[model samples]
Target: MTTHPAPAATEIAESTSDASLARTRRRSAEIEEQIAADPGRFRVLTGDRPTGNLHLGHYFGSLLNRVRLQRAGVETFVLIADYQVITDRDGVGPIRDRVLSLLADYLAVGIDPDAATIFTHSAVPALNQLMLPFLSLVTDAELRRNPTVKSELDATGERPMSGLMLTYPVHQSADILFCKANLVPVGKDQLPHLEQARVVARRFDERYGRPEGTDAPVFPQPEALLSDAASVLGTDGQKMSKSRGNTIELGMDADTTARVLKRAVTDADRHITYDPAARPEVSNLVLLTALASGRDPEAVAAEIGDGGGAALKRAATEAVNEMLAPIRARRAELAADPGYLLRVLRDGNARANAIAEATLGEVREAMHMAY
Candidate 1:
């Protein structure tokens, strides 16, 4: 009998990646159909860590989709992941201000506080309590293998990985399952994190729910709600990140935005084109213009063809400033009334706590620990 060698690690990893993408795409389609057919059946949980002011990347990537979901009548929960700021970073700098700033950004972008539940991670105790039992559902090796955690740790450079950082996926699982959120909007890179949440939900149900003769599962295995929005790159042609200082913040004035766009990197070749692979920097600018102006990127590129990089910068600056004008005005109004922002947070936190408390009660009962 001939023995075949095991597949190489890289080969296996690639295969796994492809399979995961396929599954996510398939499930996203089904969920989309379900949402359209019965808009009331799904609940969405999506959020951002309060690191800094909101940028164009946040606007185009997740914020717009969030508005679409809320308008679609889906029950939505937006968690301000304040605790997550320290996951890979040193300290939470001006965390309170950032949280309020995030809230203002949401409102400016048409996220109605009355329609959706917007809450914070630190405010929801029962939500965090779910982390205790969830931590036991997965092993150390499994946690280490989580790509999101590994990437975050790798980004931390010489800093030692903290315990919380290592178990970040479990914390995220708590974020999703605590509110029984069945739909999570995620990009392709975040699919693994959502998969880990699904694992926790399934394992918890199989081990704890069935033995109690429970009529319903303790947690819902969340599905990925993929966004078709292309990833927004920064002016420097890298991933748009606040830490890099390459983002056009939503609150920036028109002059500041113009100045930032003037410095955007582009090729020496005068001709403008939208070949993302070859001319990424130039293509990025074109894409920003297209997104802001509601035109096709390729068409934008074609229109700016032979106009060169300077013309592209001018176009992007104009389009972005025009697009953000109304949002900036609204944000300014919100900023003037800090008291109102606090009220929104207070109400959202209270609502979130009540829901989390109920979920935890059920969890404790299922584990036979409720006295």
Candidate 2:
């Protein structure tokens, strides 16, 4: 009889990490192929934090994808990540109002409540319960290595790091898994978070899933649905963010939109061009115009050749205002009726709670805690 030596801890860890990466890559490719073949066949989970009103960046980046996916008959769940707001902010005093505002914004932007399931994070207690088991599946080193966490910490400068902030990626896994979501639309920068969720799903399934021959897993590994939308820049030409105060809110009135655009930074060049690197500020406006007017960026530039920064800004402003008119009107209508908005959220929460409870039952059973 021959005896095989057990692998060292470091070797075991390395092997596990490599396997996780392989699974993620394979799953990602499968999802892409699946989407191409039949987009309506998969469940999608995507959402936003209720830190503030959404902007053009949110519109182009993820909301647009949500609308399209829902319309295409994909089962979509839009989460109001209220718990995540405290991950960075010092207080939750404003979160309630922000959550309501976010819901209104969702409605204003054409997300039909009847078509997609929209729910608040706090409304579903099962998701938070799942976080405990999920936290154990991920490692401290892995959480610390998350680029999103690192960037956020670095950006905070001297702010104290909270345990919640470090484990946010794990919480995200709970969010994704609770819905059994197979597809999560995210930007390139968010790939790491999605990858972590996939890792957690695979780990849980391997540990507590059905017998080997059955191959039944309670959670389905989610894959990232990377968006191809052009990056939306802020008024200062940086990434559009509410914190930076450079974002053009989706609900901004036509006059406010135009005023914000007028203050947008641009170069001294008299000619309009589409050189993002050399002229990011000007190029940003051109791209915005293209997105709003449904015209090519180069074509927009050609239409305004030698028109100077003033002319380019004016044209972009006009295009943006025109695009925002209907959205603003809809937002106003939604915001005026607080009772209706509350009812929408209440109904969504009930639906989400039922689904979450069912998932939690399975999770508990798999972990031998059913008694």
Whole-model lDDT values for every prediction: 0.88, 0.83
Off by over 4 Å in 1: 1-16, 155-159, 210-213
What is the TM-score (0 to 1) of candidate 2? Answer: 0.90
lDDT string, candidate 2, 10-31, tens digits: 3223423656556655666777
Per-residue lDDT of 1-371 in model 1, one digit per residue for the tens? Answer: 32222232222134238776787788789988888888899999999999999999999999999999999999999999998999877799999899999999999999999989999999999999998988877776667667876676677763669888998989999999999999999888777778788888877886678325568888987888888887889989899999999999999999999999999999999988888999899999999999999999999999988999999999999999999999999999999899999999999999999999999989988898888
Q: What is the lDDT of candidate 2?
A: 0.83
Cα deviation at 36, candidate 2, in Å, is: 5.8
Q: Specify the poorest-scoring 10-residue window by lDDT in model 2.
A: 2-11
Question: In candidate 2, residue 338 scores what lDDT?
Answer: 89
lDDT top scorer: 1
Q: At residue 324, give the lDDT of candidate 1.
A: 97
On a 0 to 100 scale, what is the lDDT of residue 121 in model 2?
90
lDDT, model 2, position 176 = 92
